[model samples]
Target: MNEMKTDTIETIKRVLAEVRKNPDLAAAMTPSTDIVNDIGLDSLQMITFILSLEDAFSLEIDFETFDFDHLASIAKLSDYIAGRMKEHV
Candidate 1:
């Protein structure tokens, strides 16, 4: 894989770790977990999680352009982040 893909994977792992720090939240997450339904992440928590991910990756996500509901699974989230990062390159 290329560096961008590697970075995307790392960012996803980091986001998962941050989300998993909460016991109640951690129990619901899996690679295929749905952020909204399975994890029960509220809007505030979702924003916070995305901000944390942005800080960790040093990338800006156009929040206005994103559909939060689609960011359900880790793979989907990773793909989104990767796409955003590519735009900055």
Candidate 2:
């Protein structure tokens, strides 16, 4: 994979490690792992997940501008975070 993809995956893993209860699940996470459906984050957990992501990346996620689809999988989240990080840069 490219450097950006590799970096993003690492960031996602770090963020997941902070918020997720299961180390096995976090370790098993791949580009295709669905954050909501596969990980089964309830509404509250999703909030915590988002907060952790924002803190981990030092990002201010504008919920109004967010596309929920980006939260579907680890790949999507990585892409979304990368894009947002670029925008801030």
Misplaced by over 4 Å in model 1 are 1-10, 23-28
Clashing pairs in 1: none
Worst 10 residues of 1 by lDDT: 22-31
Q: Which numbered prediction scores highest in TM-score against the true structure? A: 2
TM per model?
0.69, 0.87
* Cα lDDT of model 2 by residue, 59-79, tens digit: 988887788898788888888
lDDT of 1 by residue, 1-89 (tens): 57766666556655655765654544345557666666666777777888888888788878687886557776678778777878888
- Candidate models: Cα lDDT each: 0.69, 0.81
lDDT of 2 at 65: 72
Candidate 2: which stretches are off by over 4 Å? Answer: none
